[model samples]
Target chain A: MRTASPAPSRWALRVVGLGYLTLLLLAPLVAIFYKTFEHGLAPPIEAITSTNGLHALKLSLLMVVIAVPLNTIFGIGCALLLVRHKWKGNALIDSVINLPFAMSPVVIGLALFLLYGAKGWLGPDLAEAGVEILFSVPGMVLASIFVSIPFVVRETVPVLQEIGTEQEQAASTLGANAWQTFWRVTLPSIRWGVAYGVVLTTARVLGEFGAVSIVSGSRSGETETLPLYVKKAFDNFEFPAAYGASVLLALLALTTLLAMNVLKRKEDA
Target chain B: MGISVEGAVKSFGDFQALDDVSVEVPDGSLTALLGPSGSGKSTLLRAIAGLETLDAGRVTIDGEDVSTKPTQKREVGFVFQHYAAFKHMTVFENVGFGLKIRKWDKAKIADRVHELLNLVQLPGLADRYPSQLSGGQRQRMALARALAVQPQVLLLDEPFGALDARVRKDLRAWLRNLHEEMNVTTIFVTHDQEEAMDVAGQLVVMNQGRVEQSGSAEDLYEHPANEFVMSFVGEVNRLGEDFVRPHDIEVVLEADDRTEEGVVKRIVALGFEIRVEFVLGDGTDVWVQLTRNELQRLELREGQIAFLRPVQAKSFNGSTPSDPPGASTPQGSDDGGDAEVSAAV
Candidate 1:
């Protein structure tokens, strides 16, 4: 039933918002912290410091390191392309940039596997070139890149469109070449948008699980990122490590959210 | 350097923004492209600055044809209509942007920027962001930035258009003075006839994407090329099929050969001049402007019978002699020499 409260009180709206977030997000987060510490701090700390757990954490961070820059660069290029110029397929390309958001991350991982898997398309040629793709770090990195594709572009496009091209035109008329104009005028004008986008992209790359897990073959030590490792710990009855890693991941997500909020405030200012 | 647009034509979908528009700006001259909204004045200015690529036609800067040159290579200085100040950059940075792009020395750039800031009368505001400046100050800052690189020509799109009336007046005077000092071949787009006359040496009147006329203020006022130019430049009184300047109508007591008789409707004695309204036998209104001394000499009064002579009435080919409004697209067929609708019985 769609109960429409046409004129809900301000306090009622606030209560609804807070209650939903608390029930859905905060309660689970608090339970995870409680579950991790139920056997005292020693168990979670030991599990986290274990070689497999440390490797998973390192792998998650590595994914972020590799994927974030590539996406950021691609995103800025895409936003500029979508905003500044018009071509035959401009709208189509604009829609394609946000394809990752429309499709499931698991599907993205599967698509990458289909293209780069050992027996899939391009897999044999890649193998002949002595390069491993699917079930490897490269495949996982590709999935991370895919899931995080939309963040920088989605954030930057509106900002680019809002700033308009007059400043860029002015720069050009003032004798600044195209390259100079981009570095001096266009880049600085869209810096905040790009910054927020980069942060979102970093968060997405770090949090990407479904696609990376599928492509990574759920390897234990080498390809097991933090999210996959957390799922594995839970499945194997390692509750302390599972909850501890989940708490760690939640903290990372919280930090990313705080960063995004700060960036948003700065942009508004 | 002199700039010219030869047969510039631009279109957007079904709407033709510019249609075979052409104008010339002589060297070290200030010219204004005056047109109503959607008349392609800004488009013409942008074309000259190489901002908008022409579908067909060529824009020549000075003697050389720079039609295909990029905006940067054109060596032109262009100021946007809204004063598109780089919000992130300080005044110093904005003014020095061109010089920096041309690879000027850091110290030299600072010196040039300071000199420009002082030139635009914006001293001590180099470190201030554009947002900190008022509308008038921002316009001057935009002008200063455009002038910093010693460009061959300067183009501005409604430089003072956003300012209040008083600020616009002040900036207009400042711009005229600045143009005199710099002597760059400058062309600015404006819809205000007074602004075009006050600030530019020549005015190009445009209507419906076609150039109606291009001449000096006196030329345009005394002898407008068409109905568009005649009406666009200054106030004109319509009497039957004639477009008569109010100043050209003389009121006399006695009847004359070239005079039409009418009863005086009203006389408004403005401080310096007098405006007399009259109703002819057909009940058509005719307005005439006169100096206070002229009114005193003629002894004009309200509700008095008078004989009015049209000393310099013009009939444009734009408006049909029998049906005036029938010439809706008069200027559209003008380049073929349809002539202006002027002078009739």
Candidate 2:
């Protein structure tokens, strides 16, 4: 009755998953750090509090603070519209909502610039209203919002769909009004999903550069963000400064990831 | 509240879940919509409770047209088959959900929930969450929640279907007593015939998206309106009138010698049928059932003939009054209607 045990199929799947994860995720992250720290830490450490570096870092955090919350609200609205309403063209609307994910960030920034620039169609009217949008902090915020629109929406939609309308229906049948039902039932069910989406949006907003660079016009104190500081440090051949700022961006991303993990654990519970 | 569904029709994509179904549930009487699966019984129940919208027709409760009303406005208590007690809330909170949603005072909500829990025989389980309760206990909690609202009409959809057989039986009886005690207009759906007969004052049998029959359990069993209803309601042996119970026919031996008593042509045993065989005398070829010990004592054998006689019997059609059993199967029987029983001596 002594027989040898065969390897489980799951082990092969695990190996394949680990290999792909390492290649796609670990390799690129390690490469980023390797290139940044190759020259040593002094230059990078000094660059962290330097003039352009400080401006870029402060501007980037400010942009994320504004852009992430805006996108979070917009994503929740879009997800609710798509899931709860049976309006015509919902599919088309959903496809449009996802278009930002596929479109280039530069294209998004260029589109916003075209719309909000002084010479562009609506730009003159906006200028009359004393709204300086193009090549300003507003422009950078608008670009970040446009490019990060899909995260919260995509995260919340499937969870809302899976939770179904049953819980809300039960609440309604129990005599809870529409607002009460949403507050008590619908919101609680999708809170984790919304939290996950907001975290991802915050990450994308913090790391945004391509769109921000184009619309921001590299105004150091106002429009420039952390990623732009890294780019400026690299251009100036300040290797350690760029690497240190890169590490800071990496730390922000890690924080966002940690928040997402906590939220996901709560969702599982 | 009494509920009357008038010609309700509901369709889902292509399938007609309920097709022009109509039923009247009297006030304070526990009625059961008895049918096989997919017979639109649950659909009808949902329509009354306002959980489902009818494509056509109207549902009225207590003489008010509530067909278009939302579920919350209708004030109907619905108990789902899956004991849909709130998983996150304790029993007290679950039972108090209705009052809490309506913004009832805290003291009043607590007292009502406590009373309802006691009514459901779970007075001390108020602090326990639904996840901690057993199947029967969860079901009791669900009932308590439904009743706590003091809604006008109570709707239960297969309330006992998820429990084990033994537990289901006990719950079924307990529910009967609870219904009698509460006297709220109740309509429950179940496909089990025995459960319907034991619990419901009125039984509505459905088949293939239509109502086949509706009457008391005795009316349905003894006088089924159609062949489908007859076979679905209870077990019916398909034999000649003489072979059925209530028909008086002598059981005789199969031997050619002098017949001192009834004879048995062939002997076979089934669970309920202790000893059954075909009798040979009048060429009637009727089936017979005898006690196990009587067969062992009589030493009945095969291939024997004996004198046969019929005492009294009933005709399948009630057109003719009670007549003697040996009268004979008459001609011109319009349908396959026959007596429910044939007594064999």
Candidate 3:
């Protein structure tokens, strides 16, 4: 006999889930795209090409270029340290790595500002050396790095743990040194996990505003990253510019999500 | 050159995985480290391979000390139980890994890998990844990879443990033939006594982190060093302070003055032979293996009183007469037993 269809309750549950997602997520995304091109795309294009818009886009890209790679490297290092070895303070180190996820980004920005502000500790000395960290590009990049530190490490630790150390040991027995074993055996196995982490870190770094706003000072055409610029444009009654930048950011996040799904499928296959 | 472990002692916290363990494996001999689970056999194998550092003592390969050296420099090939083939790599790349690490030329690496695949009987399957191969094929690929570097010694920790019974049997025979051809000093750890006995040129029986006995299979079977060795090597019946194999005890229908009278509790016909469980007057259970023809002629059945005589048995030291059937008999025992009926000998 043929298998029976799913029960009525199962269908009901599926419909409810779809309806909720459509209302809360899909509808808003569609509305944002529709609003950006509501006036036939000319206004949106002009708003995006303006000097303020271009500068914000360039600064956001630069911030991501700096923060994503730095965080990715640090994440992999921390993940390896947490998963590969055991010593005193291991649990403490693990908790510290995950602290970024628990603490509010706003609080993190404030903490960075307090430590690097001109009147704050280490701030006066840095200012003497002509290094303006507070309300600067470096401060924004630092805040982004702080907010996204956990993405790669969290994604990679479980994968590293699941693969275990057998292959690495086997590589060693096959006359491979520690470096060779890591490069040849361990790294290849964990590359997908690292990539997944990097994708998440990139998305978080691009969308980060709470912590970045406090640290960046949101100056026009200077420290004004895309997210801050969106807020500035909206406040200045430039809806087309704000909506246009929001579409770009959303597309970036969407591309990252698609990449993550493709990588996951490849891993499964 | 052979491998030698001198008083290797390893401990994990308070639990000792190996204690004062010393074993000498001759060059070109296939030795099996035989023991039950957690008996320190795998631990000893890892220690010899330089995977596990000993808390005390040393290991030497080819008369050179390798205890303090890293695993890579020890020239030891190791195969894991789960066949730890590089999943992302094809068979060719996997087999060539060690050679590549040693900076072998590309041409040389290809030639060696080709030869190894053929030796392991998986030739022309070089482009397949580990996940694409069957369990047996994957195990063979692991073996080929381990052999690529032409290691001085090959150490396998339960190499065929994850395979099915039929595959395990086939691989065991194939391994025996491969060893005869390669002539590399090899040591494999296995909990399967039959696998160890069938393949190993020399068998080292271990228990509770100590080597119970070490010898040829026939020597260990015919004459175990102690009660532990006697029981661990093969199935045996304990009668007082003596241990006798089921085949070594004779079953007779008539009770004589010299024979021990017992009742047959059960009979199991195992195709070629019949195994009769006998409970003696002293309440000791003994198994007697009889030929099919003998069993048919005798027509022995359950509840029938029978007479048993030890055709050949060995008395072990520290084996109490009151000791239970499954007790851990002490080590360093005397090999002497009382054989009531000496006619068969």
Restricting to chain A, the TM-score for each candidate equals 0.94, 0.88, 0.96
Tell me the native contact fraction for each prediction: 0.98, 0.32, 0.94
Q: How would you encode candidate 3's per-residue C-alpha lDDT over B1-345 as one tens digit per residue?
A: 699999989999989999999999998999999999888999999998888999998998999998899999888889999998899899999999999999999999999999999988899899999999999999999999999898999999999999999999999999999999889999999999999999999999999999988999998887677778888888988887667788877777886654788999999988998899989988988898889998988888899998887766666554333222333333333334311111233
Candidate-wise lDDT, in order = 0.87, 0.79, 0.89
Task: Provide the lowest-lDDT 10-residue window in model 3 chain A.
Answer: A1-10
Chain B only, TM-score of each candidate: 0.84, 0.78, 0.90
Model 1 has fnat of 0.98
Candidate that beats the other on DockQ, 2 or 3, i.e. the better one: 3
Error of 3 at A263 (Å): 0.3
Candidates 1 and 2, the one with greater lDDT: 1
- Evaluate model 2 with DockQ and give the value: 0.37
Residues B1-345, model 2: lDDT tens digits: 788988989988888888888898888889999999999999898888788899999999999999889898988888888776665568898888889988899999999999988888998998997878999998888888888888898888999999999989999889899888889999999999999999999999988778888999998876676556776787533333322331234444442232223345677766545544554444444555556775665566776544444433334445443333444433232234554333232
A1-269 per-residue lDDT for model 2 (tens digits)? 63744578668878999999999999988987887677776666677888878888888888888988888888888899999996898989889998888999989888888888878889999999999988888888889888899999999999989877755666666777788877777777788999999999999999998888999888666667899888877898877777889988998999999999999998887
Off by over 4 Å in 2: A1-46, A49-55, A86-88, A118-121, B123-128, B237-345
Evaluated on CA atoms against the true complex, candidate 1 attains a DockQ of: 0.69
The per-model DockQ list reads 0.69, 0.37, 0.88
